[model samples]
Target: MKSSAITCNNGSFFNVFDEGMSLVCDEDLQALAIAVIQTEMKAVAKLADRIDRQFVQACHLLLDCKGRVVVTGMGKSGHIAGKIAATLASTGTPAFFVHPGEASHGDLGMITRQDVVLALSNSGETEEILTILPIIKRLGVPLIAMTGNAESALAKLASVHIDVAVEQEACPLGLAPTSSTTAALVMGDALAVSLLQSKGFTRDDFALSHPGGSLGKRLLLQVSDIMHRDAEVPMVDDSVLVSKALLEMTGKKMGMTAVVDEGRRVMGIFTDGDLRRMLEKNLDVHATRVATVMTRPCTVIASDILAAEAMQIMEAKKINALLVVDENRHLLGALNMHDLLRAGIV
Candidate 1:
């Protein structure tokens, strides 16, 4: 039986039997993985240098576009284009992906003079994309081309060409689109974020586009939306007896009560913990005033703030509840950790 030598990172060799059997050590696999990552990193790093006048022009066209951005590509580039479109749309730009092949078959109508066309092709000469170039030109839409070949037909025809050329593919054989695709993806993110900043896009704007999950609940749900209102809020007069405040807390099941002054301004807070401390002191519940035993200057939140902010305050203070008040320190509502949990803000 004859065997061949396959060199590995440690200056050692592995056996490749004539029958096609091979043994790969773990060290060799790890080394190859690290090499791929390093190659892709270099590819992405080169894109920073390409962010010049051409990049600015592309951003301007996208920003000035009255209609949505139509991103088109073929094969693997198509997949990257789809993700780029999604990122743009979610970050404040109105954009969507249009398959080049589909565009040739009537989907080109999706692109108009008001829209901007962003095309991706590592080779700069994808046939499907080229097929629709004439129609896109006829529509008079601005064409932004991303390709590896600076002199390719697509680049020459583009209103602005972004050079995403990589020195080499990360694949050892240089047969795959690993490095090139990574560079293109990073460039897409750069464009999306640059436009995001230029347009003053905000977290509230992002929440509008994503309102179905926990993210939406965190950003869109306000303290006022979830807090218990006037009747449900556990509150008692500051001069009330500790026994009376305890009854309010028990009936409300909030484990706490707000002690308000005669004018309805929050004076203090009394919780189950306060009750336990009072018990240890042997204070007469019927004779002691709630103000004398309550926790003074308790944490309170405004009604208009996000519930997520209220959660942070509670977590940092190591408390389970918050009193919702207005600018005048008047009790408006109350909420506890359970409220946040139920609203999915926690």
Candidate 2:
């Protein structure tokens, strides 16, 4: 046993505990926090080492699942189950949590034979979970059990047993679920991300699932969605003077104008930068045809391509404006850096 320090300030005391049965003073609080973190880390480390065929088998089961991954638990385990379900759902797997106690009261209707059941119970002897085990078996749904005690009832009834037994709880009393719950959460994430990879899930898939988020905007937003269209786009015919092209650019405030043919096909692009370079040469903007000053073979993007892809093209080419074109290279619209900026995509 070690001595516990009681720090008295203004006759008030703060009593804190340390790892060796010693007391933590204000000065020792950091060390106590480090111990708590290390204790939980060890649980995760042990889980990492024990990941064997059972973990791999769980991944395979989830990968091949025809429907949702139905996770259920009781008490503290139930909280972990709900979090695991949320993580899996957001990461590419279709999953949700079911309350085991509620299952006995008719919530079992939420599950089906096409789904896989992931039951979490540290002791593997949770009564609510055990009571519904027969019905889960009856429904012919595949059972995956996560428990500390492999020999316990839930494990015995499982089609695949995932033993998440931690050496000890981070809780000093060893009663509250701490290290065990952390280990379980990590294991669920491992399963979710691994299964995501096995399914060849991509950022595009994730973006679709998270459509209301910024990632969705980046991956799903198209050039056509943000481009200035119709008469809003600045354009001029090749026969127009460079000075007239500049008028279109100034009026539209796009810093550039597309030089087109009679059919509105993109012939070239004249930009403010071209004006600066031509000004140095003293070329008469009023006398030169827009085609003579425009940059030929300007970088263009398909209206249907992802806005993110268009941004990449812009950055790679070091150009700010892009002509949105059809398959025939006819100019449909115009997009500039300002457009992407206003759309909050820059």
RMSD of each: 3.3, 4.4
Per-residue error (Å), model 2, residue 255:
1.9
lDDT of 2 by residue, 20-139 (tens): 555445545667678778999988988877689988888888888899999999999999999999989988889999999999999999998899999999999999999998899999
Which candidate comes out best when scored by TM-score? 1
Residue lDDT tens for model 1, 1-346: 8988887787777888878586776677789999999999999988889999999999999999999999999998999999999999999999999999998888988787899999999999999999999988888999999999999999999999999999999999999889999999999999999999999999999999999899999989999999999789999998899999989999999999999988889998999899999999999999999999999989999999999999999999999999988999999999999999999999
Model 1 lowest lDDT segment of ten: 20-29
- Report, for all candidates in order, the number of backbone clashes: 0, 1
Model 2, global lDDT: 0.89
TM-score (all chains, Cα) for each model: 0.92, 0.85
Scanning candidate 2 in windows of ten residues, the lowest lDDT window is 1-10
Cα lDDT listed for each candidate: 0.94, 0.89
